[model samples]
Target chain A: MTLSSGTVAPGAPTRTATGSVTVRALRLLESFTAERPELSLSELARRSGTPLSTVHRLVGDLMEWGALERDPSTGRIRVGLRLWEVASLAPRALSLREAAIPVLEDVAAVTHENVQLGVREGDEVVFVERIRGRRSVRLLTRVGGRFALPPTGIGLALLAHAPADVQERVCAGPLRRFTPYTVTDPVRLRAMLAEVRRSGVAVSDRQVTDDAVSVAAPVFDRSRAIRAAVSVVVEADTGRPAQLTPLVRAAALSIGRALG
Target chain B: MTLSSGTVAPGAPTRTATGSVTVRALRLLESFTAERPELSLSELARRSGTPLSTVHRLVGDLMEWGALERDPSTGRIRVGLRLWEVASLAPRALSLREAAIPVLEDVAAVTHENVQLGVREGDEVVFVERIRGRRSVRLLTRVGGRFALPPTGIGLALLAHAPADVQERVCAGPLRRFTPYTVTDPVRLRAMLAEVRRSGVAVSDRQVTDDAVSVAAPVFDRSRAIRAAVSVVVEADTGRPAQLTPLVRAAALSIGRALG
Candidate 1:
């Protein structure tokens, strides 16, 4: 079974006929986003589109389970540490991070730049782990944050190895542009994908941000299946993408080996 | 409403009287632990004590929502990345990690050891972020992993600043010894706590592990509240705890400032 396309499916609790209560509770959680991490009880009810009574009951249960915590001062609620602890057991994120950290440390030691490990999740890249270098350029990306697959080096690297249908779907346009350098044209993006495939490396130059450039390489598991990508982001003016390419690729390979 | 000191409350779904379906479903998730990340359908049913049919229905909803994912080969289920993404927004974990990463990177660069940032949760310490140096000693702890409050440097640092009631409860005994060098005596532990409070640092030498030594310091938020703790673990016999002490303390302070 798969969730409907929208966050709250038709016949969801918001309407007269309620769907599963589990679905309604999960929708309440989904309402809390990066921009709005905390929400008052009424705000949660409004955002989740559930009635206040239902929201209060569900929130009470969630709070008791430690999946939600109330602020001492404001009476607002946020996701709880216990929830994070349980979620940390997710193999896709934490397991991969555990395997890749040592290799990432090596890459960071050499380049002293932001190092990231990401896997393709649908059409987006979800950063599983990131090692911020001591003197590297600042990045907007956060661990577990999502970004478009067309504009990031790790995204391009993962996209270059993605299935043909997925590649086609992503290249069919409506691509969001972060900067002028971001390749929004499907035709241009297709060409870049081919080049990345050929070279086994992807360079995203000032695509996500004006001052940052990232070099990324795909990682293969024991079966030689492309599993993930690793990248190193540097200041655009540094102009050392060429020098950093091998280092990033080597780290990716080492991580793949460790995953075995 | 507080949960009655166990994973599930007294009126939880386990009894003949069923609780909310949503709470029951969430309990299925709480059943997953570090020791058992993956669970077969039957195992999930048994662990959660939900009827097999009910488990089937709830698991379907969870899987559809991407809160639970099935392992391809074994058909076992595990926590999903989507859930981790949502949980990552928990301010107690991600926000603190975001502020601490840079300072941690600096500590890693200088000491090249395992640097950790942790917050107290109950009587234990939950490591929010950990940067393992390239040549650091192998550690039993992982990011999001928990350890006893008496043996780990971060744990000691956090425990030192805990409320008097919490401290008394913890020091009241049954302290598990990880190694022979571990401090199991409450009186000695209290003295060590006093020293940590006075010096704003905690050192655990060959306590949790036989071959490792760790130095830790308390982190103060803008309110001057002891919000977290930072630590660096190195191999024993290296005898540089004194040298690493200041570096870890400084990083903790820097992270606290960044948190503001």
Candidate 2:
């Protein structure tokens, strides 16, 4: 449940050069997390490590541009709707999500299980879209959330197609364990990746949790390069993971065709 | 469809000092739009108003940081998934959308019509979330899309709760017309706003399109201040808009309590 990329925590500001005003302002935005969605001026300065006066000036500029807004009653700042409007144009996430939604919906409709679409980022996988099944097993993956690339079925599928260096780095070890079935041994994980490549399907059997298992397949772009992965999670004892493999794979292929 | 704030388009670069490398680099991201979601390096330079060499350097930085990505097949640059992941932390959009999704789903289930949640931004309203009902009328609104404040039911609900200055500014307008039923007169629009406040619901009878009508109600925060609005859009001739008013109002109230 607490998976994160090794490089930066979810909302921590990056240590970019202080001379750049734009980075400083963006860092202020990064300082706001799901937990602390609102912050006062002093809290912003403290979290972003900027001078109070500089925070004031930069916040003022961002406010004027509608990148941030201050609540009239509380005087606390939150990310503005305008920022979300612009960010929605991000092709890799929004465009891909838009293309995959219908297929994911179909998968959910047929399987009645949690359906997920994810893409690899560095050594981790970021879920771009997730559909909750009405009677499916509970899932920890939230849309726009990140997870390691060795436990979840979508993660394993993405990691299987990732560059050799990324795979090697991940295989070097320290994999976090979510449940007793979660893979932690690097050798076994590497073997699992090899099997994923060989079979064109990745089945994670209760790897992330005790009560659920997932089956995933890679999605390829026109150039035949893997761009994303799709997965469906069902209650561990109810459905056979191998039997669900074809359904998930077909949905992934359908989404890839739609993307093209 | 091209509704934009006069201050700046969603992805247009602000005309700040261009000397700073960070600002120039961020400008490259701003050059992308819904109409042009992908661009080449030279096109980015031309659109962002930066020199070719400067564009090369800035694009490299952005690509390295995963703020921009190059398509392997076409070499077109696109906003990366990383940027969207970061921006997903935006509270005004994400938090509000998260809080309202359950109620929106309920409303969609009961009404079998498009359920929308929107927040006021400047003189316009930006849709934070939208749920398309199984048998709903087609809507022009999309999540993260913006529209004028005088025509749509959600817009009227948000605008009615806005400050007096905002109401005055919108009332002093040349309102665009989508259909003959769209209210273009300032006097009638003013009265409609008054009625919305009095009834706690705003009904738009074929204001946005001839085939659809929407009923909306304002969502309030724990502080008793309006935070957003929810609406249900149905086929204009198929359903009675007045009967839908209570359903929308109840959903908005449920979402308000959920937010608290």
Candidate 3:
């Protein structure tokens, strides 16, 4: 997928740190996604667009901090446990996931579907946790994995509740598509966001992947701010989004109470 | 909370560009334990024993990777979400936690106790996860917290299964005490470790805290190697240790199965 260079705002870290070699060293990390969890030093330098010397220094610092660890056999650097331990405590991710787990558990038990918890982080939604039954529909998302906040049900639910500026900024640019059903039109996406707020839940039918449909509802914090969103993803053709909506919404509400 | 000044024998990264400054920066990160999640820049430099310039440069690399995040309101450095995201995937922490969750959930549900999971990391047992029932007893250990593998039940369970060299080294000296009942004698501690292995369980009664008792059992990987342990901490005076043993051991066995 091609990212629109024009759509990348000036304030974005990707833009702000374009010239900093230290920042370039750090971007080497972004190359090690869940699907690609390890890389060689030269591979990192190549992917992050940095010199080998810069990559070496940066990797040393990162490995020292336990941000990156080397596979003993392959000597490839991968994201370290120390990094994950620290990130797991991010109040947005950990606490939200903790408060939502019991609720997510109940939802999973009831529907025997994939239950996901997510919160908005910038233009994306980071999946905080997911509980999948054996028969849960296949999906690409994993805990701590991030996805654009417009195409996912949880994303739509969160986006509908996001600040006006963030919504406008996101809608001002490129939209991504997975399947033919994925929403790509800015005006229509905005309309759907408004409808999500009015309806108290978000529904995406075969948007993320061809075989999955998701129903999600916003979770509120003690201050009545939208804190997170819970979604149930099921096999699209066999799933009844309407039938699953109330269960997902109730789980989100229960989690909201726990968060408060 | 003092660590001996030595190299991380297996995985420490040596910085050719910088000397002790590399390890010093790492020490700064090590300072952010479960008890201390955030620190000012001065605190970082002080704890690291590095010049402010070095600290500043190191912090830049760290912040770039999201291993260290600045608290937006306070402008202090805290363990970042990027770090936590990576650590949450640690096989020792995440996989162990995932494997133990169901069994821990069962124990927490049945006994309404504080269920814990931990694994050996270096000479210490790092708590990976915990499920606190509504009526759980008071406790000190926390998820992501570390303690010497000689006091807590889970720690003792792990220590029991460790190799001879590790056991001899641990029992040689530096047995810190948490309370009056803490076993400071290496000989006595060694005996306890042996008993834990023989009996396939451990009970830490008022070892760390005066009012709590933890019953623990070891969890094994597919190769029948000890990978971690699970425990349930309850009010010291409210339960029989004998009754809790079978339950904790069964839960640990269930977790081992999950791991396999």
Candidate 4:
């Protein structure tokens, strides 16, 4: 989540409002990102655009509740383990991850390729878990990171099953171009989604990066509604998407059954 | 985390204080547990001791900020994926898990035993990650769960290197017994800690359950401060703690080096 100054607008006269205090506290947390996991008090105040005094009070409340922690050696602030424990109860991420890990591990063992699980969030795909293959090509994705829905195998599988509005919003593009192989045209992207639904698999050959290709399949819940997508990524030149299709599809099925 | 009405005590007249709003928001989140991951609005209000009106407003703000989500099918509130994404940046958990996963995977592949990573929190050990062994004994632990720091091997390893005050406080009694083989006596527990320090490995033979035993070793950061613990658990009847000691220790060292 990106930190925004609009969370506590300067011109708003209700700075001390109880509701705004809660919003300010949450925004202070938003200030800590993967890039800057640790921040000093002044840095947090400046980044969050809150007054120093307000930041100090909010940080104290957060620390007392264990939402934030002070680093022992550097004395900088960081996201706390207590918060992670509570957030682990998130069913969309945790339940899906629990059901998919065994299947993903099996695929990773056999292929020695990157295995990933993702779900569509709005017009993007949010990765829930990833198992790095020992000798696989380097990946730009990380757990909890987001990527555009048109450039990844997992994204395509999810977009294929997404609602009409979501699909249209994504296909009505400013589709990002990661590599020359990335399909950016709105018409072609829609065609690919249709192909994904028909074939029950999606292939992104060197779309996200020039060195890697991924094969993905959709996972369904008990109601037969698409719940998640699973994929395996490997070196572009050596990997065969056709050969990987059945394995990926089977893994998705097993995960869905486990979820049920 | 346990939810308590004490958060917004009825006896305390400062219920409308700005600070209390932040506290109330957090306590509402604490109401969510692994067993009851989703709850209705009235359940949340009743559990948190906040009035339904207050819960309605707080839930609105929280949902708007993506700290909470409503299930599409059930209409019950659950922890949001966005919160999990933000909490994923908690350095104590995330950085440690990233460093140890490769080593833990190797150990799991070789032994087909449960491999776990944990860190000390106050007087408890909070599990950060676990890789289940297909053929291993069923464990009572889960990721993000907390347990007392005396009965399990990972807890023992962490307790051995904990500060003097923490060690004294724990050894001062009330060590809850999990099984007949659990070491609850303060004298015996102290002796076990000393042995863990001397040998650089801890063995808990059926301390947590009648069917399992584990061997754990402490992982240290660059400053030589104990940062976490890694362990392998297997069936007690056929598992050999002595045979697993070196493998667990080496994995710990490799993880520590990776952290550096």
For model 2, the superposed segments whose C-alpha errors exceed 4 Å read: A1-19, A50-54, B1-28, B48-64
Error (Å) of candidate 4 at residue A174 is 1.5
Q: Is candidate 3 or candidate 4 better by TM-score?
A: 4
In order, what lDDT does every prediction score? 0.84, 0.81, 0.76, 0.87
lDDT-based ranking = 4, 1, 2, 3
Ranked candidates, highest TM-score first: 4, 1, 2, 3
True contacts kept of each: 0.59, 0.39, 0.26, 0.52
All candidates: interface RMSD: 5.2, 8.6, 8.1, 6.3
Give residue A110's lDDT in candidate 4 (0 to 100).
93
Best by TM-score: 4
Q: After superposition, how far is residue B149 of candidate 4 from its true place, in Å?
A: 0.5
| Model 2 residue A56 distance off true place after TM-score fit, in angstroms | 3.7
Q: What is the docking quality class of candidate 4? A: acceptable
Where does candidate 2 chain B have its weakest 10-residue lDDT segment? Answer: B1-10
Q: What is the TM-score of each candidate against the true structure?
A: 0.89, 0.87, 0.78, 0.93
- The number of clashing residue pairs in each candidate reads 0, 0, 15, 0
Cα lDDT of model 4 by residue, A143-176, tens digit: 9888898899999999999999989989998899
Q: Quick one: best DockQ, which candidate?
A: 1
- For residue A249, model 3's alpha carbon misses the true position, in angstroms, by 5.3
Compose the digit string of candidate 1's lDDT tens values, residues A1-260: 35233433444332334446566677678889888989988899899888886677677768766788875545689998888998999988877887898888778777778899999888999998887776689787888789999999999999999999999999997999888898989999999999999998999999999999999999988887787899999999975888998888888889999887
lDDT score for candidate 1 against the true structure: 0.84
Task: Please provide, for model 3 over B1-260, each residue's C-alpha lDDT reduced to its tens digit, 9 standing for 90 to 100.
Answer: 11123422333233334433344444567656544567877787777676675566667656656667776555777766665565555555666666777778778779877889888766888788888776778787767667888889998999889888888888896998988988999989988988998999999988999888889999987678888898888887876667889999998889999986
Clashing residue pairs found in predicted model 1: none
TM-score of 2: 0.87
